[model samples]
Target: FQISYAGATDSSVQFIFYQPIIHGWRETDFFPCSASCGGGYQLTSAECFDLRSNQVVADQYCQYYPENIKPKPKLQECNLDPCPASDGYKHIMPYDLYHPLPRWESTPWTACSSSCGGGIQSRSISCVEEDIQGHISPVEEWKCMYIPKMPVFQPCNIFDCPKWLAQEWSPCTMTCGQGFTYRVVLCIDHRGMHTGGCSPKIKPHIKEECIVSTPCYKTKEKLPKEAKLPWYKQAQEPEEGTAVSEEPSFILEGWSTCSVTCGVGRQVRLVKCQVVLSFSQSVADLPIDECEGPKPVSQRVCYSGPCSGEATEYTPEKAELLYGSLQEFDEQYDWEYEDFTECSESCGGG
Candidate 1:
């Protein structure tokens, strides 16, 4: 005999299962020391693994697995063995053929604005170079055109603030069966200071809105977990939580090519700022009037030294023979050379 059954609409079915929490961590073997013999350094790093497939993941994942484990050092000194003596050539200190020229240098960074989360920090950089007399002199931006300028803005101290601070709420703890609410609670003072002022009893509730109902069917599609914590917070509590806009400020562009390659010369470059009306516009596209802050120096003196490679060095006597008198020689050939090559190579060995 065969039996057939029909079910009414809206009938419900429930299944229960448990997934074990997984923790995985590992340290790589040390790499070969950097130096051939003398002293050098070696390195290694700790990493986390995916429990289900045993594949390597980001190191941060390991922290949640083996709770309370301390971080390990990734670098160490090694290769203490001494090197053999060199074969006869004396070691001479190397020097840059070009003189210590002027260039831009960035000062040390200032302290972070806040102890946690988001805050702004900045540093000042200036053009500088050494003069022929061995003195450090502040040069015009143009004189330091060889290198790119350093940026003055950067982010710092971006980790999660602390436990007392209120974090946004998590999704409803359960789909439909028995649901509960959850959120992050940080302990801190009114001024956002990491203090114990928050009373244990008054802390925002971590669980709420409980309900027992039929289980809702879940789809196989899932959203990936967020990887980074929010880095910044508003300076003041605003209703919309929008960021305050800073006034437009001028930022200097890298120096342009020198107008003249050698001798006392000059160079010029355009400077611009982020004008409110020119949002997302390239620097060159912004009009000069849009630059609201202090205008950057558009032109500056660039001393590349007297034009070189034009004339070769020759003895005073040789100069006199060619130009008749020392006075005449000096007048006609103010620029001089040390010696004429067997073939004035620069002059095609004339």
Candidate 2:
């Protein structure tokens, strides 16, 4: 019996083929551990590969065929070893990885901020920590546990200030005419040190006019009434005089004019002796006598006005003459100054 197989193909027939199929996934080698030690992780990636070309390509190129499939994660844990101990780390519990403790530090102080008046200066304060290699690193302020921070602010250039200084008033420039005097004003401190910080508005006045305007003269009330009368004319009573005898007395002349116009000067008066005999004889030709009385003063201090300027002073020449008496004449003498000229300046202060 001849039996035939259903749906059979001839041995000599050929088939057409396109791209190769993506059968399975391949993973890259695990990269270096993310950290040296103390519980870090390592990573590896999964990708699709072409079977014929055997080269890495884009996922879409491999997905041209329906057999291509997307890859999944291929990561695993690494660096499970414990960390070494160091002084830079702080102790928390018994067994655990060490971490650095934070501390505070400061930089050098800065220069003074102001030039003359009060000023302030500052510096930077930073929180830092030491690493395992003994290198300093910056950290947050909150991490610096119990360290006390340094003050960033300070004072500089604290001293006294300079002020305006005025010299004493100077002498007037002229003796009898309008004139002015001047003094020096400077900027200095109380210690006589100068720094030139004085204010211009508050400086003292440096120049002023002479203030005196008139001469000084004696008042009427100051003179004695008896001093105006001649010594021989003065009233005197003898003890019941048995005989009337003429007694000699002194005669004083009026004072001369002052030698200066507006400053201290000198004046003098001449004295002469006269015989008293009822005022009937001429007294001008009377003889000198050794009278029993005090001698008169001829030289005296005189002030014309406030002392100022320069003037030539003259010395009075004295001469003596012999008269009718054998001994010496007793004469009363006094001196005074004449009125002074007007002061130099009319206004402004002196």
Candidate 3:
């Protein structure tokens, strides 16, 4: 420094910095242990102290101690006190152990909403701290970051719902002629109990049309005692009906009314035997080879009671028009048969 009053020449001055204790950087002390008791480690660092400035200085200035090793001690074991059993050390006697750090804690999950169908359930969670004698207190979520995090939510029961059920089908309603059959059907729940929860649109059918293919029996006393009959007609005893067959069969049509409404008038009838198709019961004419049968009498006497006096022409509204029916029959056949009837007694074998 230069010492002078106003306008005087600056007086020269010099200054030098030095350390009173010229010790180099060394590991002289260790930091506090991570835990006050139980096994833990304490860390030591390499640093130099300057007594002249009463402060820590950079290690680059500490070059006097060439004997000191370059790498310094890092950490060492620290055992301040024995750990209690509640501190996760079961070998030691149990005591009112407490943790200084916060950690995660959770409660058991709740029961599922349903046993079969899908449902949801949950449990309680918390970040907590424990005081003396294992007393716990809630803490912030961030405090438990050192420990593994727990999931607060999870999926519970997951499966399908109840479905419709059915029982074995019942026998057909008829032994002969067309009829129907039925069976039991129900909606069953997961617990094997009945319920109406099933959908109506998807419900199974319980009633259906079923064919008892065997024709019904009728006595023809007019038939000759020596007349040969088909195996189906010969039996007066019941026979087991069968399912509808792919083959066609001979069927009989009902007789027509008398041609004239009064006295001594002639009446005409067509062949009663026609073919009934399988599955669809449509009546049609088929070749004799397909469905041979004992043909029923086409023409018969009409006695709608004895003819009344006067015998006035009474046009019943429901009377069938014979002209159209005969015309249709003419288109199909010549109204004469010499070969199809299974009965040998039939004239011309038909």
The CA lDDT of each predicted structure is 0.49, 0.50, 0.52
Q: Show model 3 residue runs off by greater than 4 Å.
A: 1-96, 107-115, 188-202, 217-350
State residue 119's C-alpha deviation in candidate 1, in Å. 1.6
lDDT of 1 by residue, 207-273 (tens): 4554547564544432223222111232221222222222233545555775676644445554444
55-116: candidate 2 lDDT, tens digit per residue: 77776665665665554434444665555656343323321233344558889889888755
Indicate which candidate wins on lDDT: 3
How many clashes in each structure?
Answer: 17, 0, 1
Candidate 2 residue 166 C-alpha distance from true site, Å? 1.8
TM-score winner between candidates 1 and 3:
3
**Per-model TM against the reference:** 0.23, 0.31, 0.32
Residue 196, model 2: Cα distance from true site in angstroms: 3.0
Candidate 3: tens digits of C-alpha lDDT, residues 135-186: 8989666455544688867776675666777766655545666554555566
